[model samples]
Target: MFNTPGNSKGDFLEQTKAAREERALEKRRDAAAALIQANVRGWLGRLKFSQTILNDIDEIIPDVLDDTDKLHYKPATEIYHQALKFLFVWKKERDKERFAKLCRYLVASLDSDCPNIVMLVYL
Candidate 1:
């Protein structure tokens, strides 16, 4: 029988495990892409707004806000301004008071961390 110095059954098993993990990861990526495509199609068929507006709002909100770990009052304030602009435009077509109430609720939720009285003035 032929044998190599470093080649052992354990090394073969480790290699096999790594390959299996890589295949599993690839499968998960494919599934996620399919799910995203289905969601987009469904939203397009049901919602009135164009894909562009939906994409813009999605991008704008997250881009304006800092990550959870780096969140601070300044970025939060900027996010609030951007959100207000979006909300105002949306409310013109929808319910204004309900939109205002939603804004109030959001401000109240952030009060504990931001504690800036100016936020209430906007409400």
Candidate 2:
């Protein structure tokens, strides 16, 4: 069966049938492999993009908190609020430390003179 010539017509037919089934199985396997790879790439891309966004947020947090009287402060505050909500909701095991550090930084950076800002972070 393994490379030897078939001894009869029935043997040849059986050999061809097995080959066809093997080919179909290989096709299915290839399709599954492709799908798995695509999903993994998408997950990794999203994880990296999320990290980049967090870094950008870290850079702007001080500005958003310090300039409350500016016209943009209101919108920035709203964005900051949303970010806090996101951070608090993030439940990934890998990011627990990062989230905690961000929370600590936010708490420590608050200005006592601005009760609103203080309350916003606490909330």
Candidate 3:
């Protein structure tokens, strides 16, 4: 709160700055996901899920799955889905000694078994 301007317009500027920061954070997260997904997609083939599905995947899946039977049609659960337990595993390979070594030593040979289930080795 230090050095904040003491005026009504200052409040508006502060709000705008906060909004811009939020947007930048969103962009960074999206970019990070895109890089991971791109590397994954190239390795796994075209992502089985649609952008529409991926776009709202986080928010909509919860409501869509509130009724268990409704999820039957979803590709991740219903089709050639042995590899994808869920979408991505953020456990991070580097966090686990075995995985970290594998990621470092054998990552070149390690391609995704399922395009959808990405174990992010690092962000």
Candidate 4:
């Protein structure tokens, strides 16, 4: 019978855990960047977003995700609402036509997807 050293086993486990966590974090970062890019690009092309504000939002998003407090359920909800308000106002003031259409579509879509709407509304 052979026995492995406890310290070595613990070290291996720690390294594995760290690697998994790093990979998960990278995946999250990539997803966040992609989402922000798509939203910003779409709104910009439609003239619904300002380049400067979009840049600011893009900068803040990663920091928001990185901060543990912002990543929590309640804080995240607050952040989401704040972001939504900012974007809504930005769009409405910049592009009234698109803003009205989007708001109408959103309301109708929300009515159709009640559960998601409820979650978002509560958030």
TM-score, model 4 to reference: 0.37
- Local distance difference test values of all predictions, in order: 0.56, 0.61, 0.45, 0.53
Query: Where in model 2 is the C-alpha error above 4 Å?
Result: 1-6, 63-78, 81-123
Tell me the deviation in Å of residue 62 in model 1: 42
- Tens-digit per-residue lDDT, 1-123, candidate 3: 555556667889899999999999999999999999999978665444433334343332333222333322223333223223223432444225423333332232224354443233434
Q: Highest lDDT, which number?
A: 2
- Residue 10's lDDT within candidate 2 is 71
> Can you write out model 1's per-residue Cα lDDT over 61-116, one digit (the tens) per residue?
43213334343334456546656555544646554644554454455446445455
Runs of candidate 3 exceeding 4 Å displacement: 1-6, 46-123
Q: Clashing residue pairs, candidate 1? A: none
Per-model TM-score on C-alpha atoms: 0.34, 0.52, 0.31, 0.37
List candidate 1 segments past 4 Å from native. 1-6, 48-123
- Top TM-score hit: 2
| TM-score result, candidate 3 | 0.31
Model 1, C-alpha of 120: deviation from truth (Å): 46
TM-score of 1: 0.34
Better of 1 and 2 by TM-score: 2
